[model samples]
Target: MTTTAVEHGPTMNTTATAVPRSSVGLVPATATLARQKISAAIRSGDVIFAVFGPVVFFLCFYTPLHRQFELGGGDYAQFLTPIILLQAGLFTAITATETAGQDARAGVHERMMSLPIPRVAPFLGRMAWVVVRMVLTLGGGLAIGCALGFRFQGTIVETFSFVLLVVVFGSALSMVTDAIGTVARNSVSIASVLMIPQLILVMESTGLVAAQAFPDWVQPFVRNQPMSVYADTLRALASGSAVEPLAVLLWSVALLAIGVTAIVVAGRAQVKR
Candidate 1:
């Protein structure tokens, strides 16, 4: 017998190859999570609150105050629409922050960390729902505004762009709130920390009133702050005028950076623990 003829063939590996994760799955997963979150908000009656708050403000505050005070020409309702929409956005952010803080304190992050899903998925899902809530609130406010004589004087494109800007501003504000939420000890702390600054900015800025209407000592701050700049830009966009976009851009970028940094830091700290 020839020993060379008895040589065995090379062995084949029996282990199965692991399949790579598909990016396509991420979209549906994120969307599903966002929908679930939004449904929860609806069940909690937050959706009703978000949609109605602006309408109430428009009816009670803007309607009466616009008549009592000159609001830089045009229908006062038109002048006040942007601010109402902006306020609605801010309210959405506040709600988001409170929810996020509650989740963090309840150890939701810890549970999430054990899952195979991407780390940012939950945040993105919450933000997606925030945008949805904002749209609903803004839509409700716009209907109320129209009933009160608010009209879009600009082209359809400009009108859409104005809405887009409000959404962008709201999204940026939400990020900042999200950052605060991630690290805050509780919902009350989140509210207390954010409410004062929000009031100072929105009330003192050109949102509700013109810079000239403010006291001379505060005129400079009112004229130059991010909220004022945003309001001015949105006003111009709505009425078809020159927009100074720099200030709004800078504010959005700066806040987004801070928000991202805070979230990352908080997440890392949580993970380490």
Candidate 2:
């Protein structure tokens, strides 16, 4: 009997060793969380807003200003499309704050913490939704712009850069807002506060009207502000012209750095709580 037990032990050990241990991965975990976010956003109608927000914003600006801008020289549709895309990205970021806030209020983060996934999965999951919204906004904006006379005048590379820049800009902002939402209780108030600055930046920007159109006192600010710089870079890329893109690139980098740092801190805080 002892001899038979010993022999069986070796077989059992071998069988146990042959059975693999299942491991979770970041990609699959993030994907699952992302799908959760997408479904929630759909139920909340945030997904619908993603496609229509830019459409409404684009038409709002294009309808009244097109004739005047066109009369100034170039087609207004081509000139105005860049800012619309940028605004779409901003809108995506704004929506992220509210969603993140909702999750925080509902103890979603705490629930997720109990899982064996990476701590950064929640942020990445929300960002995946942000990208989806940005893509939807881009399609909607471009479609409306094309119908209104906008066209891609640049080479494939420049056009691609134009799209890439918008994504980077939006993603950076979304990260920052996500971090803000994770820690803050009043996310809706934060979102409302964000809009004031957003409106100021777009209205005072060279986006809708040339810098010269602004009062002389504000022209310098308008020309050199971050929004104007981004609009300029977007316009250059869209028109296949050469201009200094370094400023906007620098802005993007700075925002990304801030976002990364903020998000890391926010995640660490969550772990502690």
Give the top-scoring candidate (TM-score). 2
> Per-residue error at 99 for model 2, in Å?
1.0
TM-score of each: 0.86, 0.90
Per-residue alpha-carbon lDDT of candidate 1 for residues 1-273, written as tens digits (9 for 90 to 100): 666656689989999999875443557767877998889898999989888888998887775687656633547776788888887877878887887887788887887766667778778888898888889888888899889887777888888888888888788778778767877777667777777787778888887777888889999999888778877877888788777778877887886787677778867766788
lDDT of 2 at 235: 89
lDDT of 1 at 55: 90
Error of model 1, residue 15, in angstroms: 16
Residue pairs in collision within model 2: none
Best by lDDT: 2
Whole-model lDDT values for every prediction: 0.80, 0.86
RMSD of 2: 4.8
lDDT of 2 by residue, 117-206 (tens): 877778898998888888888899888988988887889999999888888889998999999988888999998888888888889999
